[model samples]
Target: MSKVTQHEATGLDDLDPATAPARDAVHFRRIVAARQQVSDAEDGLREAVQAAREAGDSWTIIGAAMDTTRQAAHERFGRAR
Candidate 1:
């Protein structure tokens, strides 16, 4: 696979970074906030997985819900409980 440059990802090949320091800063801040939100969501997902296990849900069902394989789900979250 080839690398996708920031301009490619954002479809802004003409974007001028030097002239957009404030906009870049805002984008960086938003990225940080989004990462934190993802972390929180992951924690919630782990808790939900544990709760589901406690409720007699099998790894297969959990995996199906998560769009993953049973082994993958078990490997990732089985130890949470």
Candidate 2:
């Protein structure tokens, strides 16, 4: 997936007052959709991590799969269950 820069996400560049309200509405919808997607993804990740732990996977292994430190992963998702 391509990365969206801050400028692209904010929709603030070259905004004119005449059409700003319409443009801002579109931007607000995009932000809301993005936030929902992120929330869904986090829920899935938590479920996957819980499954992996139940299947005898260690925090180190799970963290490696997530490309993060073991402590970080545990701290974030340990109480998820």
Candidate 3:
């Protein structure tokens, strides 16, 4: 497929306001859905981390994999401790 320039891609340079609204509605729905997915993923990760900590995994191991310090992990997810 060919790449579109910014104006061509958005159609903002030519399209009528009425036409833009419908297209914008679809974009808005996608934005909302993407945000929802991010929130869901965060919740899932929180649950998984809690479960792992509860299972007796060391904070050092978890923090290293998370690219954070053990103290930071405890501060963030220590409720499971």
Q: TM-score for all predictions? A: 0.68, 0.68, 0.62
Cα error, residue 67 of model 3, in Å, equals 1.5
lDDT of candidate 1 vs native? 0.89
* Model 2 residue 36 lDDT score: 96
RMSD of 3: 10.8
Model 3, stretches more than 4 Å misplaced?
A: 1-23
Candidate 3 — which pairs collide? none
Candidate that beats the other on lDDT, 2 or 3, i.e. the better one: 2
Candidate 1: how many backbone clashes? Answer: 0
Per-residue lDDT tens digits of candidate 3, residues 1-81? 898897897666897877556544788689979999999998887887787888989989878878999988878888643
Q: For residues 1-81, what per-residue lDDT tens digits would candidate 2 score against the true structure?
A: 999887778777667878766634788789989999999999899999999999999999999999999999999989845
Residue range with the least summed lDDT across 10 consecutive positions in model 2 = 19-28
Model 2: lDDT equals 0.89
